[model samples]
Target: MKTPYRLILLCFVIFLTLEGSTPVPTEKTSFQWKWKENQVLELNEYHNVFFRVGAKTVEREDKNRVVMKPKKCTPDSCLVNSWFDTYIRYGKTSGPFWKDKEFTSDFTLFRNGRYEVPNEFTMPNLRSFPSFPETPVSVSDVWKLPAEESFDFNSERIRVKVIPEYTFQGIFPWSEGNYKGNCEKITYTYPIFYSKPDGEKMVPNVPYKIFGFASGTVFFNATRGVPEFKEVKLSYTFIYPNGTVQEANFHIKGIYFLRNQINTKDKESIREDILGDLIVGYTGDPNGSKLGDRIKDHNNDKEPNGKNLGRITDTGEIPRPEKDSSLEKLPVSVRTSEDGIVFSLDSILFDFNDSKLKPDAETAVAKIAEILKKYPDREIRVSGHTDNIGKKEYNRKLSEDRAKSVLHSLVDNHKMDEKHISFKGYADDLPIAPNDSEENRHKNRRVEITLVLD
Candidate 1:
């Protein structure tokens, strides 16, 4: 008898130790962005322009002539145009002689007008040229093929050898100026020209238009027949195949000079308004119109607008669920002399006034399943309880219903053995809290699980 009692006590101690050693469930993982929050720009802001050199081919009429006839060749005979515009507005009273000045221009032609290889060729030094300015007024360029052919025509060759040449030029003009005031008005215009063959061979002439504002003070002076030169500053830029960019600035002094100056305290405001008007006029409202807004609507039937919504993982933060020890560890039990095994049913099991198990409780259920699978001789007791929420009879029925719900979920969803499961319900008599406040009331309603060891 003493040995049997000792053995039973040892088994109880081992069971308690194993139950306490079970680990608690851990939190779930989440995703987040790596960059700083303030560094990002507003959705409406503008980004820089990206340009690429397209196909290029060159044709020569004769190989060894001082003056060669230029002809169109494969992939090379292409033209690209880029443009910028600005505006200037004067008061309604100021409508008179405002001479527009044509400033310096620049151009760069590749040897055979070919695309520049990204990392292979070194950029040409802009300082090497005397005629090129440190800044440009208006610049344009074309990539041409290399003057020499260094690669074979074999179709099987994996790599080809190619060399490129570049021709750069800059133009600086006389002057520019503006005047306002007087009743009379006048307007003048100027044009700039560019050509190939060292200024000897001429491609078609391209024109740049400039306008001036002479009003208020200069308008009166213009009525008196005053002659003046208005000076304007211009800048041009060209990009080469070797990844080098060259810029030239020219000062056409007195090209549109004015004899009088306008009198006003709102110079800066006027300038900004003019600039805004020009940008909108040319770009068709940079902020986009109603049509653009409609197009951007995700649910619209039309195609999606060009917009980068960023990654889905970066949208918002996910909240973490509450932790509960009872939901993480399994309950300990021992075999009863009458029944197979018996355990207690406490009010610390399910959520307040609810039969559904919390997310954390799922882990506890999973662990119980694992144990039952290991010990096929075990049984489970699912019991429910309620505090003093209503009459004793109603409370008892509600508790019983809650207990049945938990058992059904375990047996149906978790595929547990139905024959090994039993349930019990306790009314308000089994209150775990004082039931004084809402918080305490929540603790009074719950369903507990007890494993019976065979």
Candidate 2:
């Protein structure tokens, strides 16, 4: 009696030791990003006007194309204004005014250059103008002012000023100093064309030559003056032909320049690192195959060498198959449902109302045993189930016993390793048929085998 009790206690101790020695798997980490408000730019109506010195007329022929000759002036001192209008015949369609409307002024002229008008200043009416080779006049002939005047034709000696107001909107109080403000100015030169009534054409010397001039720049300045939401106004002044001045105001509304805020709540990089480590440790693809391929492709294109090299793994080595289990040599199959091996046993394969594997189940169990022997390193899981015929608790125990019986054969009779085998017994918890029918209940009583890992 003492020996038996001692033996049981020793077994119990061994079970406890084995249970405690089991490794606890690490939990995976995920990532997300958070965004915050930065700054905004508000614009208004005060920034909407065009200034030039040209005649307005009703005669359609003379009002086709006009040019403004550049003039010399001191910085921030000159101001001029003029009205411009194009003919609009009844019952006609036309493109946008900005596409057809054009202005040419020579602030300075060292060498002659050609200017192409922008498409934004289109005529309001589709009424086509008579196409003439000499319609657009030259800048030299346009200015009627005397040569003695200071605004004479000298593009290099002229100065043009464009002042644009851009409002900044922000979440922080306007007076707060938490955020810094800055602005950038960019200038683009393009060709633009305009039409003026022939009689309204002011420059007396030139009547039908296209005047070439440089376009102005767009300015954004936070320190100079900020635009308001109501009516942000920007002024542009041009001095042309012997001290003559022209000015225009552009009225812009709802113009805001917002900057991206610094994010503090994001631990995405850390989380991604964690996930990447986990995936590499499990799936062995630290920089995922798809992502690594993309990076490699992009780098190859951008680099001068442009070599199509494969991705480098996290361990600073090219990803390759293990020597023992090369993926290239593995057999692959594509089957919709019944692709791999199948295990089937009759109803008499187990004891009545119990999960114990009977003598008759030997054939089926032998087949599975052979499979396990063939794939020694593979992990197998055996699950036992039963029909809804008895009490839930009783059925659960029976199924568990049946699973244990099957596992015992594999481990003991077939000499399979116990570490690679797992067993689970679920009574009627998961069913293959409805309990209302006898046929379905019978179908539910069975055992299943799965290949977990290789």
Candidate 3:
């Protein structure tokens, strides 16, 4: 869901190589994350947001963010299994001002800390992770990694690639609730400055001049290779050439827990109960094209459910279809994995090199829609994939089109719920087989409709 932006500012380009010019310690430790199957990680996060106008300033300092991640990692990324957080509040933490709003979503997280979610245009605050070096780090190590901060400008995508300089502060003894012992810390920060070109006039709701800085520190457990604590502070101001001037500041803090075992007391419901909130709705549209605008329109309002599509993760380990279950006898390759129940359909469902669904393919999808109705509580994702046979972007576009076709069939023709369904074009990202032979390549070209169980 990338909006084609014609403006390729200097913000979009940076050195792709790491700068390990400084060295102090010979021994090194890789900061890449390691996780076991079904491991659960929790983040009891809190946030503080501040805004300023000509003569007025409004700030909220006691906001809470609740996140849950179960280690369902593929080779490429990890499913932030289920993400739910409270709405941002502007005043006292109690009374009508208090909100229990929640949205469950599937946030794709990499081994390195980073969020793929889009940020608001006027005030850029996409919770992006400071990129980590692929190689290990030693004491006094300094490196550069681009933090891809995505935004929407005039209804199109404006991606900012800023280099966040990171320094490995080395490991030190640390202790926190449920986690204690040696932990490694990294300090990171990046600056932003933008001004309008000479000939262009300022656009409404967009800043012609921007200046900002982001600084943060992250600590990870050395033994477990996971972030145990993080604190980020961001301050920025957007000055419009024709309109009003605005300033914003945000502070984010997170307390992370790595749960190695899950017993009766470790269920999500229990965790939700601890928060004393029971509301849920739409989630962050990380790859959402217009998601930034939709959220900005709300100000402090919660995102409505079923209106815009978002990713959702299954609740617990869903059971595989039984021998006599309807799915076990379906025409597609139906299997249950750490993600969910995936329905894989081969590329033959479409015409050669075409994205439209063949008439018969529509029928097959209609059947899937009927079965999907049985699990009304579950969320759904329709992903299109292709083999390595053509231009990468072309293949991605084709996959996106094909996946949308299937999604439309389920929603329009079968009247399936669209609110809980999202589609993505993962061209050659998660391949089922290698492209070494024609047979394997054929297997790689397909569309998968997953019934993400709740």
Candidate 4:
């Protein structure tokens, strides 16, 4: 026998509870599909290299920019032209890998939660945001995408199929203002299925089957008709024909904006950072604001007292070369070992397929002569290497000739003691880099000068 007021309160409480448990429909009016013309997006990526070679760490960083030039736009479909620039930097060295490559893409922003990626632009695979549902998808929603288009690989046509799944993770906060949005967490567990032409034999000890997967979270900024940000983790596994396995992992992050905002301070900061890091970016001193002038100043800066650089120990350990002084000032790298110091000059000591010393080579040899004059008792060893492009015998001959040329230059031009110096040639055997690409092949051809503490 409840009272009338008590009965009314109970009903009201029940109504509120039901409403709280129910799902809220996505607002269709807020969605905008693509960015406007002249809008630009700047992105920075810091890669922590966990992969180790013996005991060395190879850390890297990359910077990229994308500028939009909309050719056509509509609620159902949009076509946008873009310019992309990517620069990669490694300890003390950096350069442009994609140096302002341009491309065009067509997109369809559907009412249902779906995204379509550009067919070309395979280097990045999914360059920009893929499709997302127009309506908010819940954790219960099972997302799927159309199979990716086929492509040619290694003179054979290859096919790839993709299976995508999505889940609503939570809300993502915007950086510009107090705007909070939905976050969709996705995992492509069986992301790609690769298939090659029939009758293709798998090489033993080489990978035959390769699989890829990706997991990431995308922040839905529906009002802008694009995602605010996306962070993805990608991985690939290679199964060799001999049952061995290898894997690689990559992290990709992206952020987008609807309008162009000019910030001079940020621009200046980026400029200064790039200027300081170009080559020897980690150690380059900022002489002035102007990059060219600063470079000139750095080049002019010379080492003091070059003769008092390195010393020999009674325990027979070779001493470290003085930095920014004698050999380090040249384009060559000086490395110390237990018995001696090795000056490694790859392609810098000689021209392609020719061992004849260039003007710069003469200067570098003169510097070495000065160092040798300081240590008359130390013996020298010169070794040369060539890539495996030509016949093995021919390569051996070339390498030997190159080593002799360097030795002669030291003995004749610089008057280094011929008796104290010895030379050897290792043709296409001991390679510093894989001869798979032109860049790496170029690196394989090198000359080394070692000063042994005898």
Candidate 5:
């Protein structure tokens, strides 16, 4: 053990040189958003915002379906456009408030995740993790975000400067959407501090100051070159002049899923091919459908109720599909996904390898249409799928034909509006379970009609 100190020192030097020559996991490659033309990614976001104002906890759960596609690109950045279908559902709030909005917007995003969104959107949660570093970042590396920001104070508006920090938390196993590989994790946090403006004390404005913090974690899948998942929460504390305090919290979670694009298109395009167009399509909300129609004295919106309990029309009861005996007997699998309520009709709805609807399937679709009329304000999407039974190209066309058949029946026969409905075929790209067994494969070969909640 005491052979020679010089030899031991030489061995240590050799080990250090070997380690230095080998690049670290993060340093091996730079992280960038590699959005390709005709490639589409859907971000299904679920947000829960609750404010603990004194004793009451006002809560809300809203969903967003944002379909993003690369429009045009330069060497450094690209113009990304998205369709935003969002809806809000308030619980135990001041009034029964519901909103269904659909719009299209544009964004300019760089390779490092820096982006400029149009004034149409205010996505605080999406931007919780600031832009990525310009250079390669190794594990434990830290950076400071732009700290200057403005907000409304109790008495007046003010802009303050504060430091927000982001750190590289190294790589971990990431398996989401269609990609599976090592993923980089980034964590961010920022403190909230606002001293009260110079003013007199009052009951409504007694709170002189508020302070809190916001923190979250987001994952970046290097394989896909995109954000994989995100979870963020923000909290604030309001201090009253009497030394008492009130608190509020906001939480959000989002997941990104990439759609499978058609590989061959002898005639038709593989993707939507609508990326070059920028049409501001805003289907009006359900303004004509009064909330009071569904609830008795729910919002006290007497305008609709007029002389009767503030409702559009009072039947003294609530109408629900689950209560309809005839509709409840249908042989359909209804479930909820990131997209919303999905009514899945299995391959039995059609003959083997056929897109035409069976004779009995028509009756089932008609019944489903009747139920769909209840959600007139919601958007509907008809999607076709199949098992891995044949060539992908054939399956793709078959799925598309099946989806179109259902869509036409809903629109032409049932008199359903076509403006709020759309259809697509995914071949065998999406499967509820593994295609290892006949039962699972049968589940894969199904058509799903979803009510877009976003």
Candidate 6:
């Protein structure tokens, strides 16, 4: 339909206006980490500990909660105190329960992109994402992260102070509509840079350098002050002066969020979400079976060479040793021995390198005393043994002191007659296990309680 030129031109203008009214997505985006004081950030960290023996992997899961609280804040910087609240192992062969062990530290972070750590405390694989730029950034923008940081390696065998360099590898939207919501993927890489150990216990003029490499992805949420997701894989190589190379690889993954203290109406939804988290905790590593099977196959392949790389069971169903019924009857059982009816207390009864009995020791001693009261005329003997780690004389005295400590605990705390009880120490001369490995050495440290019928 041929219309007037003026009318046609008006129609074209209207079309253009309508097209322009719709918002067009921009390629550049900006984010800021303006954390406020008293803000508490809670994170669930899933750590995979793998001891790489040749090609076989002995893997286990170490899970914990990392809590961060801002202590003080300024216009451009803030001091954050972070601590591990609880540690839980997924498998049966779990390491020590670190619930009572407090590993807390603080660091200063700046708005202008400066991350500083204390000289004394260094937590490996614990770091925040690189700071965002003051201006908007596009894809393929490369930048440098904060430096002058330190990390511990091999339980303080060596320390490395490093300045990290990073390149911004573009950002993308992560998890559109889940609990994590929309997040920004901040990708970066840091090379292996080595430095001398700057620890307090580091000897002067030591001829060795600690080297390491770390690479990771950090996901940041626009509304939250902390990263919603972070995964970092760290590899460390310790070079000794005597030309020994010890390597360690660790993988750390974190899912973090802040509590919605203001949301009262969403209480039901929050409860459901928390129940879901609890289910995940019970499940342990979701992929533990598949990964454990792969490791087991690899270890089995190496068994032809008489190599026992040990079992890498599923963290979900790691096998634990069967309970011994004899040990269960320890408190009441009185076994016949050359001296008399004897009962034994292993190193587990006491703290390491201390004569003081543990809290549970009192209950055990009470049980033993109850049994001994039935045989009032029998004389009791408490003997202590030690592993061969110290001087002969010192070990002998330590054993004697430990035996006397137990004897005194029975007499003073349990009101047992001192006249019918005696104590002795056999330091390192007798051992239940070989003193080669730590487990054997621990087994060698024991105390026996013998009751004489005379």
Each prediction's Cα lDDT score?
0.30, 0.33, 0.58, 0.48, 0.58, 0.53
Off by over 4 Å in 2: 1-344
Q: In candidate 5, where is summed lDDT lowest over 10 consecutive residues?
A: 5-14
Model 5 earns a TM-score of: 0.46
Stretches of model 4 off by over 4 angstroms after superposition = 1-34, 37-59, 91-124, 127-129, 138-142, 147-159, 174-190, 200-207, 239-245, 260-454
User: What is the number of residue pairs that collide in model 2?
Assistant: 69
- For residues 72-110, write the lDDT of model 1, one tens digit per residue: 222212121111111111232111111111111122222
| Count of backbone collisions in candidate 5 | 3
The reply for model 1, stretches above 4 Å from the true place, is 1-364
**In model 2, what is the error at residue 325, expressed in angstroms?**
39
Candidate 5 C-alpha lDDT tens digits along 1-454: 0100000000000000123444546454455665566566666655666666567666766556677666677766777666776645577322211234556767666655555655444322133135666566778888875543344333443344556688889887655344455678878888978775567444344456767787877787655666777767867676766666667676766666655432333112201121001001212124544222322332344334222221001221322322212212234556555545677876778989899988667765775687677667456888899999899999999997898888888988898865446667789999888999998898899898886543
Worst 10 residues of 4 by lDDT: 6-15
- lDDT, candidate 4, 1-454, per-residue tens: 1000000000000000123444546632222243443453323232222222235434444334444444454444444444444434454323212111223334432333233445453322342234344445555455554434233234333345665555554444534222244543433333754643479887554445657776766665444544566556656555655665555455555554444533444444433443233122133333434544444444566423332233222222334544453323335556554335666665756667787767556655665666666656444667778988999988887887787777788888888765446666789998978999998987788777776431
Predicted candidate 6 versus true structure: per-residue lDDT over 1-454, tens digit per residue: 1100000000000000123443434776555564545345656555666554345445555555555666666655667676653333334434322221335667776664454657654532334345566565666666675443244334343333444554444545554123354566766666565655466354332325656677777676544444667777877665555554556566776666554222333333332232222121123234454333433543556323212222112232323332321122232223455334566666666787888877766666665666667655444777789999999998888887788787888888887765446666789998867999998897678777776431
Error of 3 at 144 (Å): 0.5
Find the 10 residues in a row with the least total lDDT in model 2: 4-13
Q: Please state the error at residue 364 of candidate 3 in Å.
A: 52
Task: Give the Å error, residue 179, model 6.
Answer: 5.3
**Residue 451 lDDT (model 5):** 68
Candidate 2 lDDT by residue in tens digits, 64-131: 11111122222221111111222111112221111122222222211111121123322111110110
RMSD of 2: 35.7
In terms of TM-score, how similar is model 4 to the real structure? 0.41
Provide the lowest-lDDT 10-residue window in model 6: 6-15
Worst 10 residues of 3 by lDDT: 5-14
